[model samples]
Target: MKAYLDIETSSDGRITVVGMYRPSKDLKQLVLPNITSQEILDFLNDAEAIVTYNGDRFDLPVIYKHLGLDLMGCFKSLDLMYDCWEHNLYGGLKKVEKKLGIHRDLPDMNGYDAVKLWSKYETRSDRKALEVLLKYNEEDVLNLCILEELLKAKKVED
Candidate 1:
């Protein structure tokens, strides 16, 4: 099975949430203080391939540095950013996503906002901030699936 993944990190590089979405499964967000490295591994244990926008450079390395889990070493990785580059598309995930007409529920959201949200939740014990952060991550992981399908259809058409 393919796993679509994204991660949200604090400005200081601490991981606040690990968002993982597998097709036909509920979106899972492993929030801080409640997550173990093994739990993250177990969630990804059955994945034969991993799909992400710029995972090779950002997500995968972060996962490795933080959790010491070499997911790329364990599973095949398909970085959609490279696919976009081949199609003459450029920029980060949200930019490429917009170029391809992929819809997002939280368009105004970005990595900076994610960090701020985490800060709010962490410092003030704000549940609403955490909820919004989770929802933002949910959109990020789920949209990756849509983006991959669209890219595949484009490949077939060309």
Candidate 2:
């Protein structure tokens, strides 16, 4: 099975796992405090392939830093960023939308925005930031699935 994951991390290294999705299934929100390093390892162990929007550059590295787990050697990881970058398309997450032909009304929120969101949450104790962060993370993981479908179709064409 394929598992799609996206993470939101604070500048100080706290991670909130946003979402996980499998084929024929809707995305699910995972409680951040309930996650552990071993659980991530277990998910990587079970998944035949893993998909993410910008996982290689950001998500996986952050997870490795926080959890002391390096997934580089463990699973088949597909990073949409690398594929886009290979074509000289440096545009980050929005590239996924254009490449996959998916429409989402997400604001121009990126990881930097996530950092700012956490900052606001910490400084002002604003719960809305947390909710926005979760929604941002959820879109990221779901976008992975959409990109995967586009990739598979291109492979067939090739």
Candidate 3:
């Protein structure tokens, strides 16, 4: 099984959320206050491969640094960002999504905005901010699957 993953962090680089999406299971998010290494490991227990956009450089490292989960050591990792490069697609995930015409409900939101949303939830106890942050993360996780499919479908001849 393949797992698609994404994470959100605070301004200081502390992990606030870890989102994992598997085609076979309901999306699972490990949010701060309740986020734990065991939960993430368990969620990914059956995964033979983990897919992400820039996971090799970002998501995986953040996970290891924060959770000590070492996902790449446990599972085959396929970073779609490299695949995107082979097809001449460049830029961050959002930029790549826009280039491919992938729809985003929170189209204007970015990682910086994610940090602010987390701050709002933590400092002001705003559930709505947390909700939006979760939704934004949910997109990052779900869209990995879409991006993977589209990348796989691309032809070198094009």
Best lDDT among the predictions, by candidate number: 3
Q: What does candidate 3's lDDT look like per residue over 11-76, in tens digits? A: 999999999998788799988978898988888888899999899999999989877888889999
Worst 10 residues of 3 by lDDT: 149-158
Where in model 2 is the C-alpha error above 4 Å?
A: 24-34, 42-45, 85-89
Tens digit of lDDT per residue, candidate 1, span 18-127?
99888767678899976567987788878889888899999999989988888899999999999888888899888888998888889979999999999999999999
Please report the candidate that would top TM-score against the real structure: 3
Ten residues in a row with the worst lDDT in model 1?
Answer: 33-42
Which scores better on TM-score, 1 or 2? 1
lDDT of 1 at 108: 79
Reference-based lDDT, residue 7, model 3? 91
Any residue pairs clashing in model 3, and if so which?
A: none
For each candidate, give its TM-score against the true structure: 0.96, 0.78, 0.96
Instruction: Say which prediction, candidate 2 or candidate 3, comes out ahead on TM-score.
Output: 3
Clashes in each model (backbone N, CA, C under 3 Å)? 0, 0, 0
How close to the true structure is residue 127 of candidate 3, measured as C-alpha lDDT?
Answer: 99
User: Which parts of model 3 have CA positions greater than 4 angstroms off?
Assistant: 156-158
